[model samples]
Target: MGKTTNALENVFELAYNGKDYAGALGRVKAFHREVAESLAAGAGPYMMADVNEGFRDAFEALEAQLATVSALRDYDEQYDQVVSYGELLASAFVAHVLNDLRPTRWLDCRPLLRTDENWREGLVDWQATEESLRSEVLPRFQEVQTIVTQGFVGGTADGRTTTLGREGSDYTAAILAYCLRAESVTIWKDVAGLLNADPKTFPDTVRYPEISYRETIEMAYYGASVIHPKTLKPLADRNIPLRVKSFLDPAAEGTLIHDCQHPPLAPAFIRKTDQCLLSFSSKDFSFISEENLAVIFGALAQAKLKINVMQNSAISFSVCVDFSERRVHQLLDLLREQFTLHYNTGLTLFTIKNYDAASVARLTEGRRLLLEQRTRGTFQFVCQ
Candidate 1:
């Protein structure tokens, strides 16, 4: 889990479950103290006074904010305003580390209204964000080579802090690159490069030396964990190449995603774990017509449930989504009156792009499949 999740879990364990907000805050304060102490053991040229001061300031501010809270959400905005504040505190620690290393300017992109959408998850407001960045952030880059800032967070014009969805740092980088019109954007990862399959799951995964933007998008959309389609969109639009480099081995060439052509190779294997397959049958023996589909889609949209894959028959429709207990139940509540519902949970959705018979067989060999769909270039199956 990421830092934001870890911090929230700490609060959730105490404040939500244990009903001890003071205990949670105490644990956080002690943790911050330990961190400051450990860093001081080897404070060479770095200003230990500044680090100590920064930590104390942040601790006091966070304690004051959390002191007023009972649960995560009392009377604030949606997406749990209190939790979002904790998220910002988590990200600010990263900025603190950067500032300690060098003369870096730290900023919260959220308060600047760098991205739009008041929801917890956000998308770029290109015109407004670009203007904001060009005015605020760009000038600082001219003064200093490196500036540290928050990712996964932006704000609406009203200054309600919003976030670019989870794992949104890449999207944040893309936004910065697009606004700055940089030469390229590179994401440093643990992996050697972009691979056809997750190395941990598949033993013999192969890396693509270079790939096109479209292929990257397809892989990301299906289940590939390398780069998100959201991150690629802005970069692709600008024709800016993205390099997936290895932080462990900087000498490695890694993979490059640019405007280039390459021969088709092995089928890419993507596995999305913890999926739910829901089948909706008409109360009457009616075909799953456009009207039925429209109703189903609208309900799903209203519930904020994204359909990963779907199929339709004469009298029923089936769709796959990430299994969230609350959201799934909410969707079912909305549609139960219209259609008979049956669902399978704890499933894995396996997608194979540019698939072949061998690849499909290897994945579905021993599994009891819930749903399967195939097309010319893609094959997908949901299995428990």
Candidate 2:
């Protein structure tokens, strides 16, 4: 939706950030049909569609499987294989559409972004990615012309397909800007741009037209959905600018994220709902010192448990974390010998970046705050 809007207004290149093969192809296919109809009816400007060939079978199977199981992991691998197909579908369709409008060259992105075989969460071997971009993709894109390519999908070492983490296409755009040294990377979204608060949650929300890279990173860390955490790293590393523009209004200025010294800005609000707060206390009445904490942290790392906040006293320690069933139970069992455990589920953690007294009140006004922490520029509260 965002991409099509921007493309009509002379914003040519687009990078998507989503699973390559997990969504309903029929819905997306239908969406493209609607776009085609709208253009034909003169109600919309001309735009293109890209669909990945890999997703067709997976989408069909997903419909059948939906009747039986709702578990995401049931078809994680298959879903990935299918979701990656969007890149292929999108790039090819865009190439054709643009050519119909005027002469253009479309590029396939698979051979461009080389990565390791971590499957759904494949890590980009930077040297490999850089070499390919410089040698293969960059040279092809030398002249100033519109180029369309898949974003979140890449090729593995053995020539098999792999995908970046879910919603990783944003990272792909940043990487491209870093490698090609583009003027800027713009992420076209459905919304106006980065808002002070989600309009759905807080009415009369304010749009932030400019934000420092550090502030953006902090917001992403606290669960802001506008940008991915990894997306900013490459752009920030190269001092490249990024913009989150509205696909609906391609000509709007949108929000710009760049380097600056932003003095404690607005009370950045974030809510992490559906969480588990876990506490571990020594069973033998031993002090939970640095060594003990270190060991426990290592176990948490091995289990892939992400800790959002932690507090420790002499003999007991507590941490708020996300619930990933695959490893949390195992970690609890392993820690049983050294510590007693307690936890609370169905909790929401609210974080305020660059907080003030009034900002805090506006967020937790009527809600009960169970755990509260205040830092120089941040405040956090856990509530039911």
Candidate 3:
């Protein structure tokens, strides 16, 4: 849904900028129908009809909503509402395809995964979610050979749609695995398994046959693209193992992330692009004490700004965070009353885990570093 939403948002942006909404709507309708038809073409007659109806319902809902909109308003709210169609349409089509192979039931996950009112990044009410799953999802699992559900979406208590941030589907899978207490959760990817470096970015990538939960978490925290950062916590909490396997070659043994120590023998690289380095200085040139740090952190929390890396000096504190205009402005508004702020955008954060001197020199060779931090096992740099 995250990727789909991003693609659709480009269309939405065009419409908002005074491009013909009809053209965008037409494209959306055509894309939806095209996907549905392609799926239904291989299905049996009855199954094709069923799939068509499901797709029709999804299309109708989106069309009705889009028909009333002339421009983007309440960006996050509208984004949540509009983008959710992707999951609905996708799951419907997938369920039909799976049913053709075997008995399968389509499950709407909104009712089962209850969350707070946060639009783009909702906080889960775990107790409610667990209870709802136990009561709603468990019984259906017993009746059907397979239950197909959408990821990255949940419903608020007041029945509003909410998303769990971008690339949150992995977290969704982990949530289900944790609540269900499943033996293991396997994430099928294009690559064979977890790699020391992203294959596309760096050549000679080394795949990990096995990794510990702690190492995986560190990799994720350092902005690894292979897995969602939030995914490991729930699975780790329950001691549920996670497997990263290649969809192209399912027979091969993939990377296993379990409780035992199987640390990477080589440095693991992670790169986060399009970051913002926010510098906060005391208004009166006073020293940055613990109280100042607490206030800044509290404001960050209130604005839901995730700090990737931070450094503090006597009077100034600088932090690297993902660049989000709306949220950044919100944070600035909260802090402007007490602090002098400066920010540098279009920065990249690079991290190397289990780093050696050679790997550190290679990673930082040509980059102009804005900030650097090091620990016993890891090195991080904010660079232009």
Candidate 4:
């Protein structure tokens, strides 16, 4: 859905921001036509029949709705345009899927998923979304039997578009399962299952046949790309299991996250690259205390910069976070006058869960560590 989502966002950008509805329509036609053409050339997803025929028909109808420039005069209307375009794309894709598997129904969660009240732009309103799912979606869900809704996209009370955070699809699944009180949630991936380390990064990666929710949450929090960070909480809250299975070998026994009795798991390695280590010290040469920490945390929350790994010394508090230029600059602006700051970019944060001395030594052997923190179950380090 990445490519599809990009196409939809491009349409929104060109039409709403650029104020070029005709150009937006042109891009929609171009990109979707290319997709349809590539599918004809046998380049797209596995389709049994000419799925493009259905998509093309539905997409043409969507194309017809793009020229409603007068309808997008206000902010709310502009948000509607963004969301409507996204829904139209979803509808078109669902129609395409319907062609592939006939007689199977598709459910659209319109009255859709939503965001929290204060930050209406894209942050999900978990309470409202789940509540709406029970009331508006459940009855429709029962009749449809199967659902294929778009992820990352939601709505607001004022009928405006909102998005969940990036890579929010897995979170979407978790939300749906929690609301529905589903038996289990299965996420089919390209790998065997949940691995102790990303196979691409570590050739000796070990798969977890069974993992606990607590362990899985720690892994995801430490920057495991296999699942979204926010995904496990909802599933864990209801004591629901999550399965990570390979799409290639669906029958193969895959990793399961649940409260089951299993042997001690292997050390899990999680690495986050493009990090920036921010160190702040008081100008007055004061020790790092509760008051100082509070000010730093407040600035971080305001800037929305998550500390991947953090440590404090007598005189300084240091944090390693993802290097977002905009957010970092904003944080610097908020705290520059109060404290002296030093930051190093282009760093990597490596977290080893259930680690041993050997694993810690192996990672630190070649690199010069910028910061290191070791706890009972986890060890984290940042290095250039």
lDDT of every model, 2 decimals: 0.78, 0.70, 0.86, 0.76
Off by over 4 Å in 2: 1-83, 90-92, 103-108, 117-119, 142-144, 262-264
Q: What TM-scores do the predictions have?
A: 0.89, 0.77, 0.93, 0.81
Mark the 10 consecutive residues where model 4 has the least summed lDDT: 75-84
**Alpha carbon RMSD to native, model 3:** 2.3
The numbered model that scores best in lDDT is 3
Q: Is candidate 1 or 3 superior in TM-score?
A: 3
Which lDDT tens digits does candidate 1 get at residues 1-384? Answer: 135445654664455343766766666667767766666556644546756777777667655555555545522234334455554554555555666667677677775545555365665678888888888987887776676676666787877667676567788888889987989998989999999999999999999999999989889889788786588888889999999999999999999998888999689999999999999999988888999999999999877788999999999999999887768898999999999999989899999999999999998899998889999899999988
What's the distance in Å from true for residue 52, model 1? 3.3
Q: Which window of 10 residues has the lowest lDDT sum in candidate 2?
A: 8-17
lDDT (10s digit) by residue, model 3, range 316-348: 999999998878999999999999999999999
**Model 3: worst 10 consecutive residues (lDDT sum):** 65-74
lDDT of 2: 0.70
> In what order do the candidates fall by lDDT, top score first?
3, 1, 4, 2
TM-score of 1: 0.89
lDDT of 1: 0.78
> How do the residues 1-384 of candidate 4 rate in per-residue lDDT, one tens digit apiece?
336556655565565555656665566567766665554464345552445665666567555545553434653334444444454455555555554555434445435676643231356677887888878766765565555676655667776555555566688788889987889999989999999998888999999989889889989989999998888999999998999999999999999999877778889999999999999999999999999999999999888788898898899999999897868999999999999999999999999999998998887898988899999989999999
